[model samples]
Target: SQQGEEDPQALSIQEGENATMNCSYKTSINNLQWYRQNSGRGLVHLILIRSNEREKHSGRLRVTLDTSKKSSSLLITASRAADTASYFCATSGPGYSTLTFGKGTMLLVSP
Candidate 1:
């Protein structure tokens, strides 16, 4: 499958702590992205790193890509209770316009 599967299907952590999620994809990709889905809203794009980029950070979020390993990781630091949601990783293949998404990782942050 072109889609990746996130590790630790679910995670629970306290506010002010950090949460990390890993994703593994099967095929080559042009870019990989991290997204957050809340209960009622549409998916929110978190970060997208190209195959050439090794690491990227936005606010409290950090993402790393290893093209050689076909793997990527997302790290959320100083997380808050509002951060509780399902996170997904999406990848676009070299010549494909559509993106394949992973099952997702559920993160629960308690106050």
Candidate 2:
């Protein structure tokens, strides 16, 4: 069973700055995904890259995967107050339908 774990449960960044977070997993996976939740809102999928992928980028976000190390990192460049939210890493594969999510990384972009 693969389980995701994130470092620095909370992060504070100045508006217009960049924020980065890391995640580690226990087992092999088919794919890894990153999601964002705003307060009480449901999570919105940020990105998903397969195991064969090394890196992916979307808008102000960049994600990297190091399967050999079983670790991943998410970077949000030029963040804004609107980026204040909880970020989660999820894993899927090996007879798993629902993704196993990390506790989460709460990002606070101060105005």
Candidate 3:
């Protein structure tokens, strides 16, 4: 099973600041996605970038994928205390429906 690794295991920022996290994977994939999880809850899909796509955006979130480097990055602009959560990147391999998730980056936003 292929898995992704997220950098800066933890992050802390003030409200209205921006938060960025990176994910690196080992295998070829069809699509890569980012998800956010609040404490003690399930994950909510944030955005997805295909192997052929270099960048994508959703609301205040920005996602970039570099298939050549087998890596992706997620950015959240104007972060809020409500945005404090763990962010994870998941990748689905070719012909595989299962997605393997990264360790996750915990973001803390101060009010």
The top-ranked prediction according to lDDT is 1
- Expressed as tens digits, the lDDT of each residue in 40-92 for candidate 1 is 88999999999999999999999999989999999999999999999999999
lDDT of 2 by residue, 1-111 (tens): 438998889999899899999999988988999999999999999999889999999999999999999999999999999999999999987665678999999999999
Candidate 1 residue runs with Cα over 4 Å from true position: none
**Which portions of model 3 show Cα errors greater than 4 Å?**
none
Report the CA-based lDDT of candidate 3 relative to the real structure: 0.93
**Per-model lDDT:** 0.94, 0.93, 0.93
Poorest 10 consecutive residues by lDDT, candidate 3: 1-10
Each model's backbone clash number? 0, 0, 0
**Preferred candidate (TM-score higher): 2 or 3:** 3
Q: Decide which is better by lDDT, 1 or 3.
A: 1
**TM-score for each of the candidates:** 0.96, 0.94, 0.96
